[model samples]
Target: MGYKLSRRQFGQLVLAGTVVSGFSYLTNKALAQTPNLNIVGIGSTSIPTDPTAIPEVKTTESYSTHQSSVTTDIPPVGLELVLRSFTTGSTQVIADNGTPLLEPNEILSGFTSLRDGTLVVAITPLITSRRKATPNRLTFLGASSAKTLIVSGLNENQQLGSLLGTNDGRLIGLVGSKNGVPPITLVDINLKTGAISPLSQITIPKDKRVSNLAECPDGKFYTSLLGFHGETSLVQLGSNQEKPIVLAQLKVDGQEWNNGLQNLVCSGTGQLLAFGAMRYQTPNAVYSIDKKSGNMTRLENFDVTQIALVPG
Candidate 1:
């Protein structure tokens, strides 16, 4: 069954995941510390220099007027690209020589970098109507002006999930199951034609849905599964494997990660980085996952929805 949220909850939360690479544009200080290794994400807070630092609570402002104010659904905000350094704990926006890559009335659903460092992002137009259907467009961003691509071959109800850039330089994405079924499928995204080709279906439990996708150096793919009742799991699968192997039930400080995790990316050093999206009673943060043990170490208090790694 599909999970539904209220309008207020929809405004407060965003589905997170993105494929990221290329850090040649960061500051010299960040480069000197981590070299080619950097992290980019969509969030409200910057990466903390101290891992133990708690995120400060943010209060909402209130406005009062004499006339009657109409209430409406809060539209999703366009998330900005924030560059982060894991080693140095520094953060900045990804810009073209100090010029920001900001777009109006667009929500970033997913993104990945081409081999030449071109960023391909999946954008959904900002809309307030819950009944209106909005298709996602693929956009290329770099030194030049932004170019939009029309993505074809998806049904009216299908939506793209997290994006992944293969080691062989191929762009891959996850497509939710059609007919509201289980086992999401992997698809190859043709950058030139903006067409999607189905590869294989990921075998998971009936009540579970994939949140993000990542590929490691060993050629194996990893993903996080969100259960019906706040259950989360990390699984590894490959072409030769008959079925996905459960690595661990995701946990932090001996407590279950019920809020779930997304934006899974393999770091330059083969480490897995993920963004834990915020939910009621759960804090949004970044964490490093141990593939062998399924243990998680919180890296910072940033409220990131999606994240990617820049290779040196």
Candidate 2:
């Protein structure tokens, strides 16, 4: 159920992952000119936003059948509710500028910032963003409170994007076993001192695949390389490291174009925002990376299912 590319078949899988890393792009303004990485456009949720105050809306899906119903079963394209701060009247900002830290039934898979504003939601399950939604492993919550002792450990098929941490709060993600076959990993967790780290082990030897992930700002953890020979890498892990250093790579996809990349934000200084998922209505790309000339740029064309840095 993965191989749905149509932005002209992802521009021919980004021109065959760029002619196997010849490093090119004379289009997206030569990749956003690099640096601050801007390519804005917040919410569309397929269009028909506000939906008049956002109440359940008769159990969901009823903005007049979502504009005109193209239906890819869409329903995780928006929502980052938690106001009283980054005000803009009635904002949405689903990954363009920043907006994420939701914890009511948990959807955000990564984001950190402590103190006055308090937010550390790696709590999973919005249909499957990896982990915490199995035999009900005490799904992190507040009202009917569940993260009581904070023990939900079963990062099944972890594609845990937003690439864990180290900007004062680390919790990197991605770890698989059962369904995501052959070993696909890259983990780290310290959801505020719950400590448990282990980075990089990816063992996909026979038609590869991996998603977007980021953890930069000195302590690197960037990822790319999606299915059947895909590659667009950058991974770094230290502190008595157990191995994880690919420096940079944007070459690896030559076997009938399998398409890759999917949400891996890390902006605000280090600059990196990977989010490319094609197929169906096809429209999601937000590269904008440059960890020091590895170069990549392309933001705002939205379809983004995740990536939040919320702060006007």
Best by lDDT: 1
lDDT of 2 by residue, 1-312 (tens): 211112232222121001100112214553434332322222223222456433221111111211221212223234332111111223321122223222222333443322111223344333333333432111122222223124235544332433343455544555443233434555565554444455544322223345545555565555655434343465543344354455565421222222445456565456666655433336655556555544555544444344344221
Q: Model 1 shows how many backbone clashes?
A: 1
lDDT of 1: 0.56
CA lDDT scores, all candidates in order? 0.56, 0.38
lDDT of 1 at 19: 17
Off by over 4 Å in 1: 1-35, 43-106, 125-134, 177-181, 201-207, 281-283
Worst 10 residues of 2 by lDDT: 15-24
Report how far residue 17 has shifted in candidate 2, in Å: 31
